[model samples]
Target: MLEHAFVDQDGLHDFVFGGDGLSSRYDCLVITSQRAVEAVGAVLARAPSAAARARVLAMPAYTVGPATAALLASVGFSNVLGAGDAGNGSVLADIIVADATRQGALRCIFFPGRVRKDVLPQKLRAAAAVECDERVVYESRGVEGADAALRAALDAAGGAAQRAAPRAARTWVVFFAPGGADAAAATVAGRRLPAAAIGPTSAEFLAARGVRAAAVAAKPDPASLLAAIAAADAHDV
Candidate 1:
């Protein structure tokens, strides 16, 4: 069950990500997932729908992946902006900032997770009147199932054990959320796996454990995460 609300918007764009793509659509795209196609639909269906959410769906849908675009089409959002794998907020901010700088209208609605950090929005808002409304569509809390041993195993293998096993190599562990990241960091010492964080705050929390970290995913969005991973991979290679 979820408690949803409809917040009004003033010339803002909605942005969110989950699954493999976007579940919703928007005029100016900033997302990363297939399920984000229904973003506008999901947001509009909430209590007090925003005018931006309603109008953008009717115009064009811009998203980060094919599945999201397809989903948007299935749900009736006609126009879309597809940035493919580059659907993270940083990339989205780049696009939005470019256009906003040109046209001089800087306003956007951010549909983010319950625990999202606001790096991209802050950058964009500095250039324009950014109106962000975060909706807690879902929450990903730390899984209580993880114990000390399991945490050690996960960290040792760099997130997914099987994937990291084959290389017989070192991999970086990226804790996606702050709480879970902190939990994982608390019980460890002399951890071999190099750790990274999805955002600076998570890095700060994890840093208390003597774990050095690099902050990626400036917006706590998957696109940023993926990009950071790719960048790290490149550096590793």
Candidate 2:
């Protein structure tokens, strides 16, 4: 049986929005995750003027994938576009560039997590001369230590022998974010295990810690996670 590692953290709560240069409409609104969409909703909820809210609602919205687009739609964002299955900043940048080339250079506002890569904005500027503004709506912080279940599991798994066991006997741990990787590293304390990551960024985080991921999901979603596990299993075989 696979032992799951859990990181207990205060979920996304800090949100800051509304400032100079922020208006009702933009060429595009880029949201990177469901948390980012939630943050946008929070910002809209606090809008001081109805006209301001209306302006934001009227803007075209874009997201990294269908999941985030669906979340935006649920919150009454009718004009929304998604980059499909491979949801990442890089893919989103490509879509933004292609759209800008066809339609015209666009002014975009980005709602991203606190810890984000500059790839999307850099690509947009380089490929389409698009002007982009960013606001961080949420941040994830790692727990101070492993949760009880994770600690117990690690204890049960024991030392190097278990860590170096055959792939069939090892449970593949899947990390969804860099924070998760940080938590896992703290929890495992140098004990290596078969691991997988949801995307390239998370995989890179693991690699930086000398924990090479067996597989990386094409997208940051549960279905992709399963696919990553299957790929890892195949690699192990």
Candidate 3:
């Protein structure tokens, strides 16, 4: 099983956009992560007037997961829509596309991190009925001293680097996104530590780094990812 040994916290180093044109031009907004929600909340906190805050909050918000939707509600978003079963960028895109087509909504503003998958925006751009205005509200950087932390975590977790680790005592690192691949690979340099990717893009990313993922989740959700890992474990057994 994989834990903090292969990854670490993604800290939001900067918050970029304040709620500028969001209230007037866009009928709906797209938000992907909890960090993006926090960025929006910060902007709303600094809004000049209640009217400005209300205007921004009144617009319907489409988000990646239920957690994000709940955060939107807490931050005064009146209409919050979320990806129903799958919490990923692609599913969020589908939800946006369907809603845009049904409601005849045109202008959309996406509040996302600097390092995110392009699928939602790309799909929105490709759709005929929608025009997405992407705004970078935040930038995230990997935590400093993460590589050392990963090594420490592995060392604490029964020495994955042990040369005589049993054949059955396989070690795997599960990557939730492609961003963590390089650092994780470097930490497990000489070990045959298998990997499980959250989706195809991450799996491909790992593959490019000369590490093949033993499991690739069909959808980017916890259940699917865990299921993929369980299936892989079964196959190897």
Candidate 4:
């Protein structure tokens, strides 16, 4: 049922309204980086000053999550707000709509990875004539050939150990995304290894093949996955 991605909009709307309104030079921009804030911070630092730079520099950042907000803060951009503890895109989108209503004109530049969904920008543009732009900073290519070959080899060998006599094997299946879910399923399909999913999305992906997705984490990230695995172990005992 999940559709869109999580974007962070920290105090960006407040900065917009607090500023001298929308600049005739250019207005607010909403940029997102699912890849950690450090990555986005680098992009922001290197981005040319010509293509709506000052606008981004002046406005408070709306990020994809807390990591991104922290990255912005690290880079010295103040007025960040959106994601406080609940770091996700849905919450940020709601904040964008509410803030835009009070601010009048809101421009945005959304920076996304290769796998981002388009619901937020679509919804925001429909609500207001916000100056929104899409910028891609990095791309994710599929793992193939020797690199993937090594991983596949590891799975094939480890998969047997994972499935052995004990159903409660210590094998940990780290699901990063929908694709990662598929990969994990394929790797341990016939094996009796226990799995720990990253989120509902990955769970759904596994469930399609009749695999009961247990130990789902709070979020679809590495740290969350690790936490979920630990919790699952505790519950198992």
Candidate 5:
């Protein structure tokens, strides 16, 4: 079983749709997460003219993976490409580079959250050698502490004992982001528990705190997360 120790806090403010050195159209629009897609959608929905929406919809949208791509589709983006199975910035950068090479030099507009790795833009520039512009649409913040539900579950599970004997316990903590890893680490204190990470970056964060990830998901999606949990459980068995 997997337990969520942290909740997401929306850090979106100061919306800038156009202007400020941003172009209305680009060769590609990159969205790193579902939150970024939603943030961009909110800005586009407030456009004064229908043509503005249409222009954005017509642009080629690239995402970290299926989840973000699905969110982009829901927001009326016509063409969306997912970064295959691995939902990481590096993988997405590769795909973007390949596309740009096939179509010649391209301009890219990135809608990324505040707490994002510089890997995407850096890799895109180096690989594709294109002009990339980043617009900070939203920010991701971690909850200060564990919620009531998580606290109650930890109390019921006998805290340290449950973590000490992973083979006898099926409960595991899943971290989806670095912020979540930090918050969960503070909440759990020094109790060693089986942990799973959504990607390599999150896994590294947890590893820094002395919590070795039992499994790391290939992509940051529900199905991939479940697969990671299953792999962790297999080790217990």
Candidate 6:
């Protein structure tokens, strides 16, 4: 049985591809979220000609996880990388650096939400031969009431102690992105609820806000995230 309850999150937004056209010569495409893939598809639909769309599709696409890679495949991206093993942005950056080392001077175009962290770009730029262009495909609005939901969850967890629920002492906030963490950090300040980050980027963002995640799941699956949280809960006990 799942020991955790999800806090309510609101205000998800649709995004559009930011670039007017493929202005720069890029060797590969970097896409992180499935939403970004959808945005790119929208851009392709408006392309001047079929050849234009074909050109973008021909470039090797590096995705953060298998889900993103699969979406790229549906959109006609034949050459895909980082679909397996490299589960998070940091690891994907490492894979790109290694692959680029063999190919020499890689030019990368990144499609990400505007609320993203700089870890991926920073790592890519650190390699002297790699240049990354960020195209903000969408804007993400931080949802309010995450802190309030968390507080309510904590209160509920405490009440469950009368029934001796196994998770009474184990309250954690799961953050999928930096935007959510950024929005809720202030309101939840001083509460210090153990947080579980979906990936390294969220963990780093939470850490910078002085709220270090007690558990961080780098893998891009629900089972992996649950396992991370369970292990952390075990350690806390």
Judged by TM-score, which candidate is best? 5
lDDT tens per residue, model 1, 32-148? 333333434555454233444445456543454445566666666666564454335466566666766676564454554444446666766676533333343444445555565
- Separate clash counts for every candidate: 29, 0, 0, 18, 0, 0
Worst 10 residues of 1 by lDDT: 1-10
lDDT ranking, high to low: 6, 3, 5, 2, 4, 1
Cα lDDT tens digits for candidate 5, 1-237 = 122221222222222335421234467788877777777777677665777567767788888767778888889988888655448888888888877788787799887766677887998878645778887776555444445556666566556565565456566777887767765665454555567888877787777777788889888887898898897787662
What is the Å distance of residue 62 in model 6 from its true position?
1.0
lDDT score of residue 21 within candidate 2 = 21
The RMSD (Cα, Å) of candidate 4 is: 7.6
User: What lDDT does each candidate get?
Assistant: 0.52, 0.69, 0.71, 0.57, 0.70, 0.73
Checking candidate 2 for backbone clashes, the offending pairs are: none
Taking all chains together, the TM-score of candidate 5 against the true structure is 0.81
Candidate 3 error regions (>4 Å) = 1-21, 152-171, 182-185, 188-190, 199-201, 216-224
Better of 3 and 4 by TM-score: 3
- Residue 148, candidate 6: alpha-carbon lDDT: 66
- What is the lDDT for 147 in model 5? 59
lDDT of 6 by residue, 56-170 (tens): 7888899987777889999999999998778888899999999899888799989887678777899999998799987666655534555567668766754554566655556
Q: Put down candidate 4 lDDT per residue, 1-237, tens digits, no spaces.
A: 112322333333332233443344344445455453444555455444434434555566776545556666667666676745334455567778777778886766566654555666777767764656665544444454534564575567576765666545466655555555654455556554456675565577788755666678675456777887888777762
Judged by whole-model lDDT over C-alpha atoms, candidate 6 comes out at 0.73
lDDT string, candidate 3, 1-237, tens digits: 122221111221122223364556677888877677887787677666787778788888888656667788999999888644545778778878887899886788887766577788999999988999876766655677888888777665546446544645566677876667655766755555567887776676677777788898776667888888888878783
Judge candidate 2 at residue 98 and give its lDDT: 80
3 against 5, candidate with superior TM-score: 5
RMSD per prediction, one decimal? 8.5, 5.7, 5.7, 7.6, 4.9, 6.5
